[model samples]
Target: MQKTVLNEDHRRSGARMVDFGGWEMPLHYGSQIEEHHAVRRDAGMFDVSHMCVVDITGLDSAAFLRRLIANNIDRLQVAGKALYSAMLNEAGGVIDDLIVYYLDESNYRLVINAGTAAKDLRWMAGRLADWQLAATITQRREGAGALAMIAVQGPNARQKVWQALPDCRSACESLQPFFAARCGDLFIARTGYTGEDGYEITLPAEQASELWTALADTGVQPCGLGARDTLRLEAGMNLYGQDMDENISPLDAGLAWTVDLVAPRDFVGKAALVTRPQQQQFLGLLLKDRGVLRAHQKVVTSQGAGEITSGSFSPTMQQSIALARLPLAAAIGDTVEVAIRDKLLAARVVKPCFVRKGSILV
Candidate 1:
């Protein structure tokens, strides 16, 4: 399995390591609940270096991206503006969801899910070739302007970040949400997956360890994938392989907002999405009984049955929560039963649940 620059740091901190998408990463340091609270109250750091960062630069970069992603890249006009999009196959199924950073008219940076790196590259390369566009994938080598991504997330996340790196204040203080700035050798983006106000800083790998140590000194807890998963799930964010995959369309994944079927431009999956009928719909499930929800659990609704795509014990809500693909007839405030171990438990179907900054949004 591959290791990141923080492999030793994670090991030293006594983190429980697990194989995530072929990368040996920290699952948790000790108590996942504690880590979850740390992010809600104070600040927490996550090593997101496992994610793939691809750079697209050419005279046709804008046109290439418009054709590549389902969302319209034209929405991203200002420098450092970021747009979240889903890359789709020709069948209108999702390939992966990614954040595209509009660095300039000729250059754009994309951060994609770790599990889809190779396939995403191959797919993009093939698409670029057909468009006669020049494309290159930036590799994170031992010595280069590589990005060692650290996501500092929480309600107080931005405050802690400014305190840790004073030099970044000038550029980041007035930055709008979902915007990024190039701070010397570091690029600080006001973005994160944990549904908090924070920065995902990408800097030289060699210089990252010291910055991480500094963040730690400032009482920013070192969170692992365990907490990260729960946080994102609480935020109603979709996990690539679980919530949506190559077999699912973004429209059915509750991510139709990310798809741009209009705007007079053709994307890879536009044709199929327009012509197809959406069968399943994504939703949030809150367990009304004392039980835990897990992936692949059968969701029984009065309309029919669906399946739990991603489910977990929500630390913040102190209840079991889940994201499931249910029938469109299933409405909010409906009562549903999820199949647990040997028994069925009742759950409430609500709008996609979110717990941000220590408060649950119901």
Candidate 2:
């Protein structure tokens, strides 16, 4: 398994290590629940260096990205504006969900998921070749000038980050959400997966360890994948492999908002999405009875049978919640039954978001 630059730090901190997408990552330092609470009540940091960073640059960069992603990149007129988009296959299934940063007319940065780096690169290379576009795709995940990412998240996440890197505070303090500002060697983006107000800092690889130590010294708790999963699930964010995958359409995966079909621009899978139609409605489920929701569990609804794509006991809500793809006929206030251990448990349907910004939405 590949180890990140912070592997030794995690070991020194007594983090329980586990294999995740062929990379050895920290499951937790000692208590996953404590780490979860830390993010909600205060601040926490994650060593997300395993993720892939791809840079696209050339005279045709804008044109290339316009055809590559489902979301229209034309909206990104200002430098440092970021867009969350899905790259799809020709059949409308999601190849991967990523964030694109518009640095200039000729350069864009994409941060893709850790597991799909190779596949994403192959697809992008093939597409670029087929289009005969004059764009250069460079992987910044290894060797010289490699970048490392650290996600500091929670209500006090930004302040703690400022405490560590005081130089970045002035430049990034006023940045809006989904926007990024280049602070010297740091690319501080007001973005995170934990559904909290924070920044995902990308900097040179060798500087990651020092920053991690600095954040820790500033009372930022070190969280692991265990807390990260529950936090994102509570925030109603989709996990790539669990909630959506290569075989899953973004529309059915609760990501229709990310797809921009109203724009005049053409993307990779617009035709298929227009023709395929959305078969399922992705929504949230709150367990009304005693049972924990898990993925792949059968859902019995009045409209039709559905399934849980991702579920967990929300630490913030103190109840079992889930994100499921049910029939379009299933309304938000409807009650449904979930199959668990050969027994049916009652659950309430609600919006996909269960929590955001330390507030309960459902």
Model 1: ten consecutive residues of lowest lDDT: 134-143
Residue 276, candidate 2: C-alpha displacement in angstroms: 1.1
Q: Write the per-residue lDDT of candidate 2 for residues 1-362, one digit (tens) a residue.
A: 99999999999999999999999999999999999999999999999999999999999999999999999899999999999999999999999999999999999999999999999999999999999999999999898989999999999999999999998899999999999999999999999999899999999999999999999999999999999999999998999999999899999998998999998899998999999989999999999998899999999998999999999988889999999999999999999999999999999999988889889998
Off by over 4 Å in 2: none
Q: Model 2: clashing residue pairs?
A: none
TM-score (C-alpha, index-matched) for candidate 2: 0.99
The local lDDT score (0 to 100) that residue 103 gets in candidate 2 is 98
C-alpha lDDT score of every prediction, in listed order: 0.89, 0.95
lDDT of 1 at 162: 87
Quality of model 2 by C-alpha lDDT: 0.95
Candidate that scores best on lDDT: 2
Q: Compared with the true structure, what per-residue lDDT tens digits does model 1 show for residues 126-188?
A: 898898876555545334666688999988888888889988899998989899999898889
TM-score of each: 0.97, 0.99
